[model samples]
Target chain A: MECMTENGGYAAGCRENRRDRATMQSVIPDAIEVDDIAKQFGEVRALDGVSFGVARGTVLGLLGPNGAGKTTAVRILTTTMRPDRGRASVLGLDVDHDAQRVRESIGLAGQYAAVDESLTGSENLWMMGRLTHLSQSASRSRSKELLVRFGLDDAGDRQVKTYSGGMRRRLDLAAALVHRPSVLFLDEPTTGLDPRSRRGLWDVIGELVADGTTLLLTTQYLEEADRLADRIVVIDQGQVIAEGTSAQLKARIGTTIIEAVFADPASAEGARTLLAPLGELTDADDGRALSLQVNTGPRSIMDAVGALERAAIEPLTLAVREPTLDDVFLRLTGQRVE
Target chain B: MVPARARVRRLTLGWTVRDSLTVTKRNLLTLTRNPELVVFATIQPVLFVLMFRYVFGGAIQVPGEDYVNFLMPGIWAQAVVFGAVSTAVGLAEDLQSGLIERFRSLPMAPSAVLVGRTNADLVRDVFVIALMCVVGFLVGFRNQTDALAFLAALLLMLAFGYSMAWVFAVFGLRAPNAETAQAAAFPVMAVLVFASSAFVPTETMPGWLQVFADHQPVTAVVDAVRALVLGGPTASYVVTAVAWIVGIVVVFGTLAVVRYRRVT
Candidate 1:
């Protein structure tokens, strides 16, 4: 990125980015580059000036509430849907002008399994191979290999309608890889799976990234993002609310939460006033309890606890720990989501 | 390692057609596995031939004497049109199911997947058309047109079958769901099949309806098939029918391709 900058700073990276964009190399170290892209559906604006980028091979967790444009952005980058405004290129190919090439370079598993119910597991995989422009011999061979790898070889000859949901999702992912795309887009890949199966898929995704495939995953499950993503991006109403490494985003919300259980309303009132200086204090779920979120250190925690006890509110419990991604999402989007 | 031109051309018609054919073969295998669908898809066309040829065969008369000969051409056209619809429904289902989106991610030609699907539909329609002919023969229907003329009729119906697919393709893309696509296409299918001279001679119909039906392109197509199969006076209609088929191809073909671009 630096070599292209003769004037130093922006000039080098700017020139390289332009060259990379023109040549279709996608070598900006960022696997995805999104500018002010937005989309509208009838009266609703699905995406509103959303922009973010993910470096190569690093899983960027996409999180938002149900109506958020998480899936919409994934669809745009995967070349399945074109944005009405703003330009998006995956692997340096403009989605509109070079969709065919972009498609070849990226693999997408949408929110649902798009497998043909009539086709057998083997036939579905082979069909994907054929659709990917593979020869008869090559498609057949690749289908066989993927079937074995995905643990579907035993059910390969059975119809897809007969396969379980987990098996179907696995087959869908396998089919996406028939062409061996360097970039893989998964839109809520683990939505309906049981815990075991979801974990199984998580392992598969990790292995894929380890193999150098850059993955852009849109998931609502906070744990899925926390487990897989190198960096997490929180989007709400089609705009980036916040983005950072998982730790950085969490740190933004502060550490240490103090929980105090009051004997009555009188004690709870006093606890709130006593804990004011430690940090932000708020009423807990129950009317008799109050909690304080503060920085992670003994001075803060001890002082906060001492004040609460002195206020005649004998604490039920008190603890200090770092904030989770949920707090980060709440702080940025004004709404907490799973 | 290959040059850019060579790589892009690697996905051209020659290779894409091979891919399409292989995809069609796989789909055919999948369909054959579902014996129920194969039976269900072919049954309606066969029943149409049997019911119309025997029950209404004698009641309806052409300019020439024999009802069987007259019914043969009409039944063939009807069979081809009806048989092609299964492919349209299949395409709609694929769209709803995410199969088309999955296909878009591949390096294959966009036309290739649809072509493969059409190929399977054509194969299925051809077989169904032939079966209806057999059923037609059982009920005393016969084609007196020479072998070349009969071949011409088959070619016309086949071309019409493939061309009719574009209208349904648009529906399949635009419809919110597969079930809606199936429901919407049938009414249009019924209008064309009924509006044309598929069931009765346009001359025998009520005067105003006759004029409208006669001038319509489907009527020209039916007239060509009738002339080709039963040796009627439809030479001019055959020329007009070919032109009509071409026009439908261009118009609806554009719509289907445009709709595909929108969806993708």
Candidate 2:
């Protein structure tokens, strides 16, 4: 779609421009780097020495439960908030010492869609473009180009207040892309969106990554991280407890799970005892259901059902499923991702 | 293709100014689109003018002048002060809505948001003042001075309003929400505008209260604007008014900017 520059330029041209500047100094392997960043609000430590790095032209999904400092870290890396005791750099420029340069090289779509409700979609984009120092014609053309790219061209002249939630989100994303920043930060971008809208945004993000843009996205949706992230960092409370690819995280949780739901609490206990030989049985807090970590794949489910049938245990439902990112989060943090 | 040189150029003062103006344009555009805001802002001043001219004008006598003439300047000064409240509410709204965060994340000059907000509200205050002037003229409020003097009076009132906008911008940033920002602005407005020579002569008040009324910034602004419009000694009052305006802008403007930087 030639969406890199909003003016029909390859994304590499912008990368080359940044490379020329980076080479003048020292080359930066990562598009963004955070080291021991900390922030506190009076008595509460919002971010406790969080550190991460995003390799150039890749997506780093920051997975965290609420209050886990994902937004705080994003704010620090975007040069909007200063860390209490550590450092961050974006595109090889120090966020604190060279905040202006860092701001020029990055775009941020905050947890909330931050477009002005009073202005038209085009006006909002035009304002962002101008603020980034694009010339008047450039700003106008870029706004139009972004509107079309984001599928907002039909509603570009409408006030933002009239936009649906998904439309506002797309406009907000378009606003961030107006200046063609090399590194983009989306803080829970798909949050509050329906599944269809979320899928649409995911496609747009995938395209941006394919075009060589570096993205640091924070999301509470484990499935989203698994689907779109090249690497995922899971944070709990105010610290990162686990970091790896989606597969690596899932692998840590084992291969398969045999989930059985019985008609009554008594049958669930009987099913659990009958399926004890299959694999490790995870403690099911719900009396009417039980889950066992099966070492074997689908065959283990058959074994479990056969054993239950032999024991004359009538299970309401039984299935075999792979360990999802949700199970990984629950295992690592002792808390559910959602 | 986008030019690399253009992308990497250092931000100039001209660019900052242009960016600020763009933000200002957005603010004004929003104001125009929201008819209720304009109507509400302008209606208050008109009501004040009508109420004072009809209800209080008959009982209050200002030596040799008509009450409408005496009340016009006061109404204008009061209207400008009240108009500044929108700055606080507007800024707080932007903050609560996350628009401020978006601007903060952008590469524009840090002062652009504050400058743009204050400048746009000043333009609104100008409109409100002109509307009040028309209302005043209809009610037999005549200007004894020349057109230049009247223009100076209007400019001084706008300058005072602009400074008040900065003062409220600080409150807006401190406020947790827009409603709180609006509430926080009221006490300051009342203490400054109502306690002054806006509606009544300072001489008629108690001696202890009169000291504050006569010396406060609003009194100076109102007296200066009144003298300029009604043919009285204006030199000292004009100096005091300008001093108050500049002083407020310096103290509150610096504080607002500092607060803005620390708000993350």
Candidate 3:
């Protein structure tokens, strides 16, 4: 919880206007804290000095591309794998020294669904509950509750192999939640899922948060992080490149993009030169479109329009928009988040 | 309800055993649901019993005893050993499917996954062995010993089968996938079952091969069961069988747990 007092103060203050929000902030504490964890797999350094923390009841998105060590970090924090150096804790218990204690307070739903394919959905959850030391009656009742909650009531008695991808993912999540763990780790929970299923999982995650479970969610989807993360830490090539709220990260780009699609490539090139002084200009879509990063926000559109008028270059379309998380990622990591 | 903080400190040996049994129940449930697997598993040993009893029984002679009596113990030894390979295949599937990762994340004992899998497979070996015994009876195999001796023989077979399950449990965890597990298990199983007294008499083999075939674990188990079932000097063979079982369980069970800790 020491990390929470330091890292969560700013986010908590922003919500302090509401009485309930302030109470929640004061009541709960840091649920996960990872400090300079470094792990190496032979010649490849999977994680190097990666550090972050999640406040209780908040979602901290570990945003990175494939092999960026998001899953590695999640594994270390969940006590399923140990880091070669440094330390992590879940619910204030050391992951390495007090691994069993840490495990008792946390649940993990990995990238792939981990439910037994041969077992029915309810049976899978019940088995998980029993493993967590619930009594038989309690396990059964809890399994029933979870199956109903995950919208799998009708499919509860069917083998997991008979389930659709989405249903299986839901069952996996339900299995993790069997003991109502105080903290949860979801490593790309919706990776291969369709949009509808992804949204369904997001809703389930939202509900978990609402019930005050701290979550560490790792995903390559910028939009998923933007929608769900209270705070985000971007990792690339085994290092933390940036850490902030989604809006804060977006603000780091510090420019509005003014994009103008001209009728012809020559006009687009001409417009790029004309608007070069306003901001950085680059041709997109094989010179069919021009995008300029201007610091003047909407005013950049007016400037572009005025310049085009004087040049007698009537652009087909013009728009100005703020930089997105994608721009922030591209600026920081020199690659798209995906 | 216990507070979360309090529960974190409450891990006990009893809880570990309970959790392992829970995992065992889950595995056994799968067998019940997939009846085809059981049917296929039983079919292989029955085929072995029939092929050996009728096809090779007349040609291979054990002096002063019916061929069926001598062959049935060997079949039981081979059947349980083959049944143990399923433990490897099942564990490999669990590892490849990410179920092991799920279990690793739980607060349960780290040994539970291995213990549960081996325990379930032993139960399966017991059932398969009983079926094979009925098949043995139909093929003219008879037990001349008392009820207690027969019971001891059954227990010894199960104990040996459980140890073999651990041996293959190590192989299963090391295999990249279920198919590879099955492939890896077959050659070792073939050598142990075929080279030992489980098939042809060890005396009929060549000098060097006989030395190994007579001393190997499978031969010891087969000889012990044969003596118990056919009324012979049983004490020495029973001690040797127990010793083999204990040795296999210690060596391979430790190896399996070590591999489980290191696997992803």
Candidate 4:
């Protein structure tokens, strides 16, 4: 949670960085850069000229729904797959030309948990350590260290097939860190975890960021991106539709949502027409609820209630909230992120 | 001090060996955790031995030898070749589970996973073949030749099995899942194993059937091993068997490596 909270300050710092962005780009350097990278699989264009960069020691959330080319971008950046056009580099090394060296400095946890189920948790990590060229003793020690750090000490000797889904994810992340990689790519790291497990993973990832590990995290969950990422690059259908900080993305919608729910469709419809002049009506599901975006904030809330009252419409419930990332996503893509 | 290029070359070579062995140990450890994997691999052929030796023994005739004597080499060859199917199944399972993707992303040698898998499965094949040999003895089969010749036969069967491991590696990479790998491998292997001279000599067959039975790789290996262990001319069959083994290893080994590199 230290890094999670610190991220707000970090993002503010990044905003200040905007004034000197050009000079800072020359000095600090980007840990990962994708320049118009494109990839096609048979009839499907998985990535269509996508471009972005992650500054050193910052988290970049590649936010998108399924099949949006986030994993494709990650695969190209991690040196596991090649793009059909353009280029990418990691830590100043070309991903395609210096793939071996790139691999030595980076770690990746793919969408699927990739640890061997037949091997013990300790054995999986130890084997990864050995493959990364650690000595036998070093491998054993690192395995033990990571097992404890990830709260897998008691299950270290058990086969991974016996582990729960959340435990397997922790072990997978542990395996990726065994080599102390400088840059890490996690594709949908908490895609299938429960809320509690996802939050726990977020904390661990937050700690990693606090230690200055540059991370490229792809996720479908907007709250995950909002909570952890210093910057977000929202992609849809293999294209970057929006890129900004969480607050900035939310600000793009430029309004607060006023939702009024009535007991019946006729009353809801009545309220909609009465409240039309107050703001632009957006989503009113099944005609029983009405949602509108008003730019004046709290004053608009008073206006909406007064308008409804004058029309003799009794809303079963009414609430006002700032636009969430979900609202931004829906506004940008014309479809919900889910 | 070494030149920069040579130093990097030495490091790459060192890591290749180290990484491959690490993966090999990982696969072997799975066997220790689940001994039934080996037991089931051995038990299937043992059942074949019993079924063939007792039920078919009284019906079939070998010109100058007991049916068990001729059958033992065939059974050993069958067991070793069939053992190779696990290579395909194991690899397909790894691919399906995304473990292969993890390995590809690591700073290891490109061929390390394949090398580790085939080598470990070869070691398993050796164990299963040796156990089949003991089963052969218990069921009244004996080697007519000296100990050196017997050792040569065992080694030959192992090499043939190792080659088949590469062939199955291709099937594994092409298959989408473990079940598909097993399904594709077993039927093709069943045809190759049962249609060859492993079960009966081609001399008793029709001309067209004998042509296939006498010329296939499985038949060449079985005939070579049978000759080395059961007292017959050894040079030609051994050479032919070795040639087929080398050819298969070259072609399918290359194919498997290429498929592995392109695997998504």
On lDDT, the candidate that comes out on top is 4
Which stretches of model 4 miss by more than 4 angstroms? A1-26, A259-275, A281-291, A296-320, B1-11
Candidate 4, after superposition: displacement of residue A236 in Å?
1.6
Candidate 4 residue A271 Cα shift, in angstroms, is 7.8
How many backbone clashes does every candidate have?
1, 0, 0, 0
Q: Tell me the deviation in Å of residue A322 in model 4.
A: 2.2
Over 4 Å off in model 3, which ranges? Answer: A1-29, A260-276, A284-290, A296-298, A305-318, B1-3
lDDT of 2 by residue, B1-264 (tens): 122224665668887788789989999999999979978988988998888888877887687788898898898888888889899999999999899998888889888999999989988988888898899999998999999999999999999999999999999999999999999999989898778889889988899999999989999999999989989799999999999999999999999999999886
Q: A188, model 1: CA deviation in Å?
A: 1.1
DockQ of 3: 0.68
- Report residue A233 deviation for candidate 4 (angstroms): 1.3
Candidate 2 DockQ vs. native:
0.61
Ranking by TM-score: 3, 4, 2, 1
Spell out the clash pairs found in candidate 1: A5-A12
Candidate 3's residue-wise lDDT over A64-106, tens digit each? 9999999899888877788999988777789998888778888
- Which wins on TM-score, candidate 1 or candidate 3? 3
**Candidate 4 structure quality by residue, lDDT tens digits, A218-299:** 9999988887787899998889999987778888888998887899999988888888998899766577998988984578
Weakest 10 consecutive residues of candidate 3 chain A by summed lDDT: A1-10
- DockQ of each candidate's interface versus the true one? 0.48, 0.61, 0.68, 0.51
Cα lDDT tens digits, model 4, B1-264, are 111112122236778888889988999998778899899889989999999999988898988989999998889878877888989999998999999988888879978898899989888988898899899999999899999999999999999999999999999999999999999999889988988889888898899888988889999999999999988799999999999999999999899999998997
CAPRI quality of model 4: medium
Q: Which candidate wins on TM-score?
A: 3
Stretches off by above 4 angstroms in model 2 are: A1-28, A259-273, A281-291, A296-319, B1-6
Tens digit of per-residue lDDT, candidate 1, span A238-329: 88888876666776776767776767777777777777877987777887787778887688887886776576567566555566677777
